[model samples]
Target: MVFEYILKKNGLDPSTDLTIDQSISFGLTAAAFTSSDADYTIEFEPFATTLELEGNGSVVASLGTESGYVPYTAYSARKSYIKQHPEVIQSFTNAIQRGLDYVNSHSSEEIAKTISPQFKETPLDKLTQIVERYKAQDTWKEDTVFEESSFELLERILEEAGQLKETVPYKELVTTEFSTKAVK
Candidate 1:
């Protein structure tokens, strides 16, 4: 989506000008680039670190700042599910908020040490670098509330990518009721 947006913003049509192929996974994308099957691949940290560790490639375009695409994670539920289990939603949101708080308060090295065991194949130094990069980018939100401007930017990007037909109002798309309760 960011690719499409960037291309269009630069007055180029992505669909007509670019030969885009979808890879099944980020690892596969990295493999494609490494094998000389593809010229470039869009990837984020940890995985990008893995690619570099394998001596495949280096990150050329850093979207961390230019894209205004921070807070790269979200949780969602079906409207019916949310209506039926509001408390569950609150519980989930609250737990995530607490986790985000812990991450924000702790150093990247501390976070890397805590989560490193789960990613046994990833070297500690690489994992630490990924964590530190994300921390520096302020990738995690301090609270669960969705920011309107960021949401609008996401919608614009999607629209530019032709994934969305029309602009959807933020209130219609997201319910902050649970997030508000969770943050408190």
Candidate 2:
């Protein structure tokens, strides 16, 4: 969404010319960064050959998993970064808030169906089960509230790379105004 917003600001029509799923892997600090890290990339031609380039940078910067395994002090570092890169604050917040809204509004079945349809054997049932398990997980929030701990992890990454311009205040970076309409 951030990338699309940037493109739109440049007077580009994303839907007509681009199809982007904006999911950025942020770091704990500006010191933390990743490049060409995505497993796959595509060229301009419609049938262009695909490339596998896990470009560069560390493996990860946060919990590394939604279940919170591989624990690290990333959240702390991410929060500190917000205090530095105020300009990028809104974009970061908007993206998460938008994602959370989509997740909250849809049922596991509906979401799974919309997200991917290539699941293997017994897909519909399996997908439903997966969604149910996801719903059972605790502490799901659909609001956009800039979390210091969460940003701390991102901070460690961007800071290391000297990406921060001005420290952003947590309060200025987020709002729940769209929370109600965000979810289905």
Candidate 3:
């Protein structure tokens, strides 16, 4: 859902050097492999992280200030630990602030009517509560931009792992010109 659209929409060159790491089973852990010459990666969920970031070791990328991924459903103990420790858990709050602001500014009926078609499985009333919770507390950061600094961290991670064969030029990997258009 994320990688496919974001990659193609940005005109990333594929085939010659493009590769995705869906191996580790979790997007977070799988992201470690991106340190290689691999063009792109997508490991949505390890189905479980115990099997992902812990065993066989995982290189944690130092994003500096480029932002990071936070699970929207981080009320779980494991998530709480990651959030409380370090990395971009603050990004989680930032994204939630934006989403909550959106939900609060909109009316309940308006929200329901607007999203009903988008989520056919979720009943209107259930969605209403979901929106209410989202308005009440933010748990997702779907709007964060992919910063170059973050990509640089990925490069260093791969290099340290001895996975990088050459270098991935910035222009070849990202295009903020278009992404910024969506930024608020």
TM-score of each: 0.84, 0.33, 0.31
In candidate 2, what are the lDDT values of residues 1-184, reduced to their tens digit?
2333334545777788664434433322211222333432222111111111222332221113332221122122255665576446545556667766777888878866875555543356456655554556533465654356655545444453357655666556544333333333
Q: After superposition, how far is residue 84 of candidate 1 from its true place, in Å?
A: 3.5
Best by TM-score: 1
> What is residue 172's positional error in candidate 3, in angstroms?
2.8
> For residues 1-184, could you state the per-residue lDDT of candidate 3 as single tens digits?
2333233435754333366545554535544643456433333222122223345333232121122332223222254565475345444545555664565578766777787898786667666655554444343334445566656755655554457877798667554432343444
Model 2 regions more than 4 Å off: 1-85, 117-124, 144-184
Report RMSD (Å) for each prediction in the order shown: 2.4, 16.0, 17.1
Candidate 1: the clashing residue pairs are none
Candidate numbers sorted by lDDT from highest down: 1, 3, 2
Off by over 4 Å in 3: 1-67, 70-109, 132-145, 149-169, 181-184
Deviation in Å, model 2, residue 30 alpha carbon = 36
Candidate 2 contains a number of clashing pairs equal to 41
- The pairs that clash in candidate 3 are 25-46, 26-46, 27-43, 35-158
Q: How many Å off is the CA of 21 in candidate 2?
A: 38
lDDT of each candidate versus the true structure? 0.80, 0.44, 0.47
What is the alpha-carbon lDDT of model 1 when measured against the actual structure?
0.80
